[model samples]
Target chain A: MRFQKLKRFSCFVFYSIFKTKMVKKLASKNNKIELGLLENSSFKALLNSKYQFSKKIVIVDENTQELCWPFLLTTFEELKEAEVIVLPTGEENKVMEVCFQVWGAFTNYQVQRNDLIINLGGGVVTDMGGFIASVFKRGVDFINIPTTLLAMVDASVGGKTGINLDVHKNQLGVFSNPELTICDASFLATLPEKEMISGKAEIIKHALINSRSFFDELTQYLEGVPNDEILAKAIQIKADIVDQDFREQGERKKLNFGHTIGHSIEGLLLHNKIEVTHGECVAWGMLVEAYISHEVATLPKNELQEIEQLIRGQYETLAINDTIFDSLIQLMKHDKKNNSDKINFTLLQKIGLAKINYQLEEDVILRALNHVFGQ
Target chain B: MRFQKLKRFSCFVFYSIFKTKMVKKLASKNNKIELGLLENSSFKALLNSKYQFSKKIVIVDENTQELCWPFLLTTFEELKEAEVIVLPTGEENKVMEVCFQVWGAFTNYQVQRNDLIINLGGGVVTDMGGFIASVFKRGVDFINIPTTLLAMVDASVGGKTGINLDVHKNQLGVFSNPELTICDASFLATLPEKEMISGKAEIIKHALINSRSFFDELTQYLEGVPNDEILAKAIQIKADIVDQDFREQGERKKLNFGHTIGHSIEGLLLHNKIEVTHGECVAWGMLVEAYISHEVATLPKNELQEIEQLIRGQYETLAINDTIFDSLIQLMKHDKKNNSDKINFTLLQKIGLAKINYQLEEDVILRALNHVFGQ
Candidate 1:
C-alpha cells in the first residue's frame, strides 16, 4: 500500500512538471496528432472534464497491457473505470476472426457510440483495433496511443484501419479516422530494440519519397531508435500526403513507394511462418524497387547503389530467390493499388521524388528480385 | 441462334423507347438516385463510353440472380461480361461469414479498387454488397439496383451499408454512399405479396414523421406495392433527413422513430427462429412507440389510436408477452442510437412531426409494450 501510494504521488509530480502548457500538436484535416510527454497531453483535461463519454474501452496487445497500460491508468482518474480488451501480439493475429471476437466482446460490454475507445498498443493493435472500433455501430470515437515506433511514425498518421484476409495484407479495411492520436515517446522504453529498428524503415521510406535532407539525417542516426524530431518529420510526410489525398485516388500513392513490394514479400514470408519484421521486409523491398527504378525509371545508377548499400547494411536480407519470384509476383498482382492485370508500383524518380501508377512487367520485376535476393 | 438474336433485338427496342434523353435523376450530394426506367439512366453512356473500369462485378441474391441479373445482362453490353456473386435469400445469411466468403471470392476474381460492384437485389443484397465493396480495398465504387420495394425506398437512399452481427440488425457497417442507385419498378414483379406488404411499414413511418397528405395517400392505396410517386416521396423523406445529418449526430434520429423498438422485437424473434420480416416488426414497433408518445410526449390520444388502428389492421402482432418485455428492453438498450443505459427513442409529437433523443425510463417503455402486446 505504501509503495502504491508513492508511485501515484510520483506520477502526479511528473505530470505537474510536464503539463500540457508546452504541448506539441500536429493537425491534419482528418485528425489531431498529439506528440510529446503523455503527462503534457490534452487527454487529461478531455477525459477528466465534462466529457459525454459513457464508457472507456482500452484495447491493448499482451505486451502493451503489461508494459504501457499501467502508466496511463495511474495518471488519469477517468481511466480507473475503463475496461481493457487485451489482444495477442504480432502481425499473425491481425485477422478477421480476431476482429469478430473483439466485436462480440464490445457487444457483451454494451459499448455504445458515445463510448471512447483508446487503442493503446503497436501496429497490429492499432490497425485491427481501429478497424474493430470503426465497424462497431458504424464507428465510435477512438484515441490511438501508438506504443511502438512503427505505429508512431507510420500507422499513427494515416486514417487506414484493416485486418488481413488469409495471406493477403489489409485485404479488408475502411478509411476511418480516429478522434485523436497521442504518440508518447515514453512508451518506446517498453519496445524491444529489434522493434525500434523495424520502425525506422518507414522513416527511411518517408525520407526517400519526400526529402533528401531527412534521408541524410537517417543515415547518421543508424545505431538506435529515431528521436522526436525524426518521428515528427516522418509523421508529417505521411499526414501531408494523406490530407492532400485522403482516399489514395491520386498523390497519396507516393507514400506506397516501397509498400507494393514490401507487402508481397512480407505476405509470402509470414504465410510460410518465417519470422520477419515489416520494417525488415520493407527495407529489402526498397532495395529491389530501387534496382528496378535504375534499370527502367529515371533513378540514377549511383543513387540506386546508395539505397541498396543503405538497406543491405541495415537489414539482413531474406533467403530463396528464383522459386519465390513467381509467387511473389502473384502476390504483388493482388496489391490493393492495382486496377488491372499488371502490378502497380510507386517507384522513385530520384532520391526525394516518386512516380505513381507504374505498371511494370512480370519479367522486369523478377529480374530485380533476382538481383536483390540472388545476391 | 434465331431466338437469341430476337431477344437481343427486343431488348434494344425496349431500351430505345425509354432512352437516356428523358432520365428522371434526383440529386443528393453523396449519390444520384436514378428513378423510373433503368434504360433511361446514365449507366449506358458510362459503361459503353470511355470509362476506365477494368471489370464489372455484380452482387446479387438467388432471387434477383434469376429474375433481375438477366435483364441487366441483356440490356447493357458491359454487363454481358460482368461476373456475378450470388448470395442466399433472406436475413439469416446477413452475417460476417457470408461477407468473408464473398471477400475471398473477390480476391479469387481479382476485383480491383477501380472495378464497379452492382448490387442487384433487395435489402439484403444492397446492404451486404455495399459493405463488401466498401471494406474491400478500402472502398470500391458500387451501384445499388434495389429490386424489392423496401430496398428501393429505404436501403438505397441513406448511404448506410452493413450486415447484421448475430441477431442484432446492422451492428457492423460503414456509412459509404454508392455511385448510383437505380430503382427500377419493373423488378417489383418478382417480389412476393408478403414482401411488398413488409416494405410498406417504412413508407408509413416516413409519412408519420414528415407529411400527413402522404399518409392519407398511403391509406387509399392499401392493395399492392407502392407506385413510383410514393417510392420517390418515401426516398425523398429519408434522403432529406440523411443529407442534413449523414452521421446521425443530430436531426437524422427522426428517421429512427420505429427502429429502436422494432430492432429489439425483430432481434428477439429472429434469434428464436420465429419467421418474421423486418417490416412486420417495425409496424408493431411504431404502434408501441406511438402509444408511449401519447402517454408522455404530448402526442394526442386520437393520433395514437389512429396509428394503432392502422398498424393493427395491417400487421399481425408477434407472440410477445409481458415476460418478453425485460429482454426487449435489454435489446433496446443495446441499440446503436443509444448513448447511455437509458433507451434512446424518437417519439412522435404529432402525426407529421418527430422529437429525437428521448431517453425514456424502462417503466414507461414497459407500460407501452404491455398496452400493445397484452391485448
Candidate 2:
C-alpha cells in the first residue's frame, strides 16, 4: 500500500516538473492516465501549448450539460469552441446504437484523429465515450472528466472502456486508456445521496480485497462522504492491481471481488427496466459473496461479520424473489469473465486478500443467493 | 526489404520446428500472420496441442459459404464442431447493424474468452469479423482465412480490422491482428475476373510506393492472377513499411496513396446505390493520384506516363459526372487522414518512392478529379 502511494506520488512529481501544471496526478501504469483535480489541471496550458487539437468535443448527458458543463466552459477559455454532444442520461442509453449516433455526429463535425473528446458525465458517459473515441478511425485520444464519485475512483483505475449489449454487462468494449482524467470532488456536490452510497460501496470493496488499514480508516466515513485522501487511496488500491494486469489475465481478477455477481445482478435488473444503481447491486453482491467466501474459501467468520455489519448499516437489503435465482445463475454463466459453462468468481481468502478462478457450482451459488435474500 | 522475407523465413522455420505441421508461412512482423497454402496448414495439430479453446466459431459470408466452406470443412476435422455464422454479401452489408446481429449470435452461442473465431471469407468477412471479435467482451483471439486476393495481400499486411459506417468507407474500426492469418490461393479459383483485377490494383500500388524492382516484376503478370511469389512480395513491401510504422504517423501513409481518393469515390458511389469494387476504385484512384504526383510532387514524368498506361490497360475507366467532381472533393474533406481544412495526401516522389503530409487544396483536388474523369 505504501509502495502504491509512493509510485503515484513519483508520477505527480514527474508531471509537475515537465508539464508546469501542478495537480495531484497519478500515471496509472501503462494507461498513461494523468488524473488530478479539475481546478488544478490547466486545460488552457495543454491546448495552447505544443498540443494542438483540430477539434475539441465534450460528451455530456442531459444532466452533466446542465449541472457541470457551464462550470467547465467558463473555467477553461480554450474549451469555449469545443462542440457539445449531449447524450440521453442513464445506463439504459449506454448501447451501440447510442455510440452509432455519436459517431454519426462526429462524422457531421468532421472529427479527425487530431481532435480530443472530453467525457463529462458519470460511468456511462465515460465508458460509452471511451468506446466511441477508441473505435473512431482506429482511435482518437480523450480526456475523461468523471462527474460522479463512482467514475472518479472506478473509471480512473482499470482503463476499461465499454458499453453494454442486451442483458450482458460490458459485452462490447476494448481496453483503452484516456490521455488524461480530471477528477475534482466539487462535482460530487451534485451527485445524489444514493450515488454517493453506491460509490462508497466500491471503496469498501476495495478495502476488503486490498488493505486492512484502508478498511480500518473507512469506519469513520460509514455515513459521511470520504475526503480526497480516502478517494485517492481507493483509486490507488485498484490501480496497483490493474497496473500489474491490464488485460485481466491473472492478478487483475482480484479487483473483481464483488463485480462477478454485481454485473450479473446489475444486468438482470437493467434488462427488466428495474431502477437499480450499479453500486447498489455491487453492495448487495459483496454481501452475498462474503457469505460464500466464509463458507467455501478461508474468510474468517468474525471478519465476515464485520463486513456484513458495515454493508447492512450503509445499504438497504434487496428483496430478490426466489424464482429469479435461476435467472441470476443464467446471467452469471454469460458473464464476460467466464470462459466456459461454469461461473467464474473472485472471493475473499481473507480480508485484504482475494483468490481468483473460483468455479463455484450452481447449488452453492443458489444457496448463497438464498442466504443473502432470506428466501 | 530482403530482411523482411528472411525474417518471415526464420519465423516459418520456428513454427515448423515447434509444431508438427509445415505451412509456407510468413510472419507479417508483429501481426503473426501464418500465411500459406490451405492444404499445408494443420488445424488439427494446433487444436489438439497446447492450445485449448473452449469453443470455435467460423464467420463466413454467403459467397464464401457456397464456394469455400466445403473445402475448409473437409480439410480440417478439428473444425467439425465449430459453429458457422453466415453474413450477407458485399460492402453494403458491412455495417454495425450486421455486427449487432453477429454479436447477438455470439451471446446465444455463449462465445467466451477462450473461444476461437476463424474468419473464412473475403475482405468484408475478414474485416467485419475481426472487428466483431475485437470488441466482443473486450476481445477474443481470432484466426483469419482470407478467401479473396485483396484481403490476402492488404488485410494480411496491416493489422486494421473495420466495418463501414453509413456511406463512409471503414469509418468505424480498430487496428488489431489475428492470432494467425492463412492466405490460400485456392480461394482465388472461385473469384470473378473483376475481383482478380481489383486485387491486382493493390499489388500495383504496393510496388509503386515501395520497390522499382517489384514494379518491373509485376508488368509480367499484366493479364494474369499474381503467383504466390508475387502475392508474398506485395505483402512483404507493405509489411516492411508497416513494421517501421504501424500507426500510420509517417511512412505507413504511403499505403494510402490510392486509398485517399479511392475511399471518397467508393463512399460516394455506395451512397448513390452504385456498385463498384474496392479494387476498381483504387485502380482509378491511383491514376488520379499519379496525376497529382506529377503536378505537385517531384515524381518523374515518365513514371506517371507508365502508371497511366498500365492503369488504362487494366481497369475499365469510370465515367464520373463533371458535377460529381465537387461531391468527390466534399467526400475527400471527410477522410479520416485529414487533420485540418486542407486534405492530407501521400503522393509519389518517383516510381517506388512516396512523400507524406502534402496538404492539397480543394481546387487542386477538383482539377485532378476532372483530369482523371476526362470532364
Candidate 3:
C-alpha cells in the first residue's frame, strides 16, 4: 500500500510538471488567438502589422461603455475612429434578439466583410460580438478585449463564441477563434468583489482539473484577489487544453468539470428570472459535482472535503430540494454534451485529474443533490 | 495577327483540357462531401457504410414532402424510421422564426449530436436545414438530398448554409459543409419548366466563368431540358470552384459573376412584394454584366452579343426604369462582396475567363442597364 501511494504521488508530480511545461510551450507558439497583456504600443503594432481593416467597430455593454471604454479608447489611439455600439449590461441581454439588433446595426453602418469589430466588455460582449462577426456575411474578422476577469481567463481565451438560446446558456453559437484576445488585468481593478469571486471560480476549476500546485497557490488568494501572473497561468492552462481540442472532442472537455451542473443551475435561475452571477452557480455546482466525484470516481475524501469547504465558504449553497433536483436533472439531459438520453459529465478522479464523458445513474445524481442540500 | 490568333486557340485548348483533368481528379479525391447519384442501392450503401446515425430526421417542405420524400423513403430502408419535419415552401419562410421552430422540433425529438438531419427538398430546405444542423449543439452531421435543379446544381454542392434576415437574402448563415450531397436527376422529372430555367442560370454562370465549350453545350439545352450528365457536370464545376475557395477570398468570387445585380433585383422584388424567380433576375444580370464586361474589360463585342442574345432569347427582359435604377445601385453598394464604398464586380475579360474584384464606373453600369433596357 505504501509503495502504491508513492507511485501515485510520483506520477501526479511528473504529470503536473509535464502539463505545466506543455502549456507554457503552447502559450508561446499560439498565434491563432494571441492572449496578450494589453499595452498601447503592442495593441497599435498588432493592428498595423496584422490587420488591414477598412473600418473598426467597438461593441460594449452599458457597464463597459461607462467603465472600460474610455480607458480602452485612450490606450489605443487607432480606436478613435471606431464606431461604438452599446448593448445592455448582464446575461439577460445575451440572446437572439440582441444579436438581431446588432446585426441590424452592422447593416445600418454597412460593416463590410473586411472591417474589424472590437468586442470590449465581459463574456456577453465577447460572446455576442464573436457570434455576430462569425455569421455576418458568412464571417468577418474580430478581436476580443475582455474587460472582466472571468472573461479574460476563461470565456475570451476559448474560441467558443455564442449567445444564450431562450434560457439555455451558449445553446446557439459557433467555434470561431478571435484574431486577438487582449487580456488587460487593469480592467479588473474596478470590478466588484462578487465579480472577482465569479472569475475565481473558473480559475479554481482550471487548477483543480490540471495542477495541484496551482490549486494550492490559488488557496492563498482565497481571502484576496489573484495577481496578473496567476491569471496569465490560468489563461495559459485553458489555451493549452483548447489547442489540443478546439471542438471539445477529447481533453478539452475537462474544462467543463464544473460547467455541466453549473450551466444547469445557471439556466434554471435564468429561466426563473432570478439574478445570479455565473461564478456563484458554478461554485455551487463544483461542490455538488465534487461530491459525485468522490462517490463514483473515487476522489479522495480529504480532497473532496477541502474542495467542498473552499467552494462552500466562497458562495452560498443553493437550496436544491426535490422539485429543483427534478428540474436540474431535466436541464442536464438537454445538455449539448449528452449523447442520446445519457447525461455525460466531466468528473474529478482526484485533484489535478479529471475523467471526461463520465455517465452516472439518475438516482445517484438525485442523491448527490440531496447531499449538497444537506437533506 | 493570324499566327497570334492560332497561338491563342492552342492555349485555350490546352488550358481547357488541363482544367477539366484537374477538376476530375479533385472530384474523385473529395471524401469530405461525397457527390453521388441517388439510386436505391448506392444511397442504401452510402448510409450503411459511411454513417452510423442513431436517429434520422428528414427536413422537407410541403411540396417536396409529397413529391420527393416518398421516393427517398423507398430508396433507403434506413430512413424507414426517420421522422418527417414539414416546413412551409417558399423563400419567404427562410427566416429565424422558422429556424426557431425547427430548433424547437429538434429539442422535442431529442435529436442527439450523432443523429442525422437529411435535407430532402430544394434550396430553401437544404440551405435552412444545413444552417439548423450547423448551429444545433454547435453542429450535427447533415446530408443534402436536393430535390430541385437549383439546389442540386448550386445550393447543395457548396458549404454555404443560411437563412434570410427580413428582406435581406441569406443575411444570417455560416460556411458549414454537409457530410454528403446525393443529386438524383430523377427528382428533376417533377420539376416545372420555370424552375428548370432558373437552375440553368447558375449552370450558365458556371460555364461563362470556367469554360466556353461548356457554354456551347449549355446552349443546346436552352431550347430543351438537359440530361443527368449535363446536370452532374454543372455540379462538378461549382464543386471545383468551392473546393478551391470555400470562403470566397480569391478564386470563388468568379462564381458571383451575375449575382451582384441579380441579388439586388431579387431583393427589391421580394421587398416590394413583386414575385420574381432568382433565375430570371440572374438572367437579366448576365445581360447587363456581360455589357459591362464588354465596355470595361475589353470583352469581344461578338462574344458579348452572343451571351446577351442567348439569355434574352430564353428569358423575357424585365423593364428597368430610372426609379428602379436608384434602388438597384443602392442595393449593389450594400453587397457583401463590396469592400468599403467601391461596388466590386466579377467582370469577364473574355468568355470562359472571369476577372474577379473588377470595379466599373457608375456611368458605365448605368449605360449597361440602359442598353439592356433598349433605352
- Strongest candidate by DockQ: 1
The candidates, ranked best first by TM-score, are: 1, 2, 3
Give a tens-digit lDDT track for model 1, residues A1-375. 344445445534543444523557886777689887777788877676535466989999988877778877887888999999998888999999888888999999999887888999998988888899999989887889998999998886789999998889999999988878988876776678889878989999999999989988889987764666777788888899999999999899998888888999999999999998999888888888998888888999889988988998988868657888899899998899897888889999999988898998898898898898875
- For model 3, the DockQ equals 0.55
* Runs with alpha carbons beyond 4 Å of true place in candidate 2: A1-22, A33-36, B1-22
Q: After superposition, how far is residue B115 of candidate 1 from its true place, in Å?
A: 0.6
Per-candidate local distance difference test: 0.85, 0.83, 0.80
lDDT of 2 by residue, B1-375 (tens): 343334334534543543424456664576665555566775556666634655889999998887778766766777788899999999999999999999999999999877888899889999999999999999988888887889988975577889998778888988887877777675676678888889899999999998898999899876755666787788778788888898878889999998889999999898888889999999989999999999999888899899989999988887587878888888888898998989999999999998899999987777787788864
| Candidate that beats the other on TM-score, 1 or 3, i.e. the better one | 1
> Which has the greatest lDDT?
1
Q: Which portions of model 1 show Cα errors greater than 4 Å?
A: A1-21, A49-52, B1-22, B49-52
Interface RMSD of candidate 3?
1.1
In model 1, the Cα lDDT at residue A143 comes to 84
Candidate 2 residue-wise lDDT at B90: 92
TM-scores of chain A across the candidates, in order, are: 0.94, 0.92, 0.90
Off by over 4 Å in 3: A1-37, A49-53, B1-36, B40-46, B49-53
- On the 0 to 100 scale, the lDDT of residue A22 in model 2 is 40
Question: lDDT by residue for model 3 over A248-311, one digit each (tens)?
Answer: 8889889998887899999998788887889988888887789899988979999999998898
Model 3, backbone clash pairs (residues 3+ apart or across chains), number: 0
